[model samples]
Target: MAECDAEWELCKENIQPLRQGRSVSALHQALCQQQEGNHTALNQQKQSVHQTSRLYFTFESELRLYDGDDPLDVWVRCGLLG
Candidate 1:
């Protein structure tokens, strides 16, 4: 994590020259938001993904790819429903 923080510092240094009319504070805010997922958007996205995956796995009817009855579903459902 410290190594990654050092790399983030290097990235901030490298980006300093690119800002023309931009405020240093704005640049700092953007960097802080992006550094190692320290942003609200990342948390929101993670929550969204978690909810989606839970819904996906809970709905075994959709996951039933084959046409006929699958015996594996019984065992899996037994575990999940327990």
Candidate 2:
């Protein structure tokens, strides 16, 4: 686990920060998958997931509606749901 953490720290050095920080566990899993010698298949799977995520975010942004009257309404709705 310490070795994985060290390796992930090194790997993260070259990556640009996103709005949300990257996951350490995800990085460790990716490293393990990389060592399994299925680069092409793994790359394709990663690409597919990234593409789908991008599409979902794009659509969500485009379709989002805001009444602009009360931003706190969302929190109220969430609190009600919870």
Candidate 3:
């Protein structure tokens, strides 16, 4: 959990400056620039809200996986390993 928070903080620190600058706006404009029938507009809207929230919740849920044994499939057993 701490590791995930640290990584997220590091990423935010690195991205903060660009987000504060006009680069983010320009990037958004570039991404949104499309034809009338293009699906980019709808996709961007969905990603901006729904997808972002889903990803955040997913990250939080992933922390629970670290509470016990290793998360890899090899560690899971049907009954008893012995």
Candidate 4:
């Protein structure tokens, strides 16, 4: 588990927390980005978050399709359950 520990050490500051935990590939990619000066990824992340935040705010009030369940499950009610 030294490799895992090393990877975590290399990218600990850049890793974002998630409910399912960090992906190994994502951790490696972050390490590579850090080795490559890290500015590009930081800026891109900032812009992406800003755009997503704006989109969320703009469409959050209008999004009424979901009823707190998976919409695709409704296909079963339309005779597709067979």
Candidate maximizing TM-score:
2
How much does candidate 1 score in TM-score?
0.33
Q: Taking the tens digit of each residue's C-alpha lDDT, what string does model 2 give over 4-78?
A: 999888877566778888899999999988887687888889999998888667655544664667765554553
TM-score of each: 0.33, 0.34, 0.27, 0.32
| TM-score of decoy 4 | 0.32
Q: Which 10 successive residues of model 2 have the least lDDT summed?
A: 73-82
RMSD of each: 9.9, 17.0, 17.4, 16.3
Residue-level lDDT of model 1, residues 1-82, one tens digit each, is 9999988887775444544577889879888878857667788999999987887676665456535477556446536543
Colliding pairs, model 2: none
Can you write out model 4's per-residue Cα lDDT over 20-81, one digit (the tens) per residue? 98789988998987877778778899999998887665555334454756655544443334
Q: Which model is ahead, 2 or 4, in terms of TM-score?
A: 2
Residue 18 Cα positional deviation in candidate 3, in Å, after optimal superposition: 46
lDDT of 2 at 53: 86
Query: Which of candidates 1 and 4 is the stronger one according to TM-score?
Result: 1
lDDT of 3 by residue, 1-82 (tens): 9999988877774444554466667777776765533787777887799966876666556645556565543233321122
* Candidate 2 C-alpha error for residue 34, in Å: 12
Stretches off by above 4 angstroms in model 3 are 1-43, 68-82
Runs in model 4 with CA error above 4 Å? 1-36, 63-82
The full ranking of all candidates by TM-score, starting with the best, is: 2, 1, 4, 3
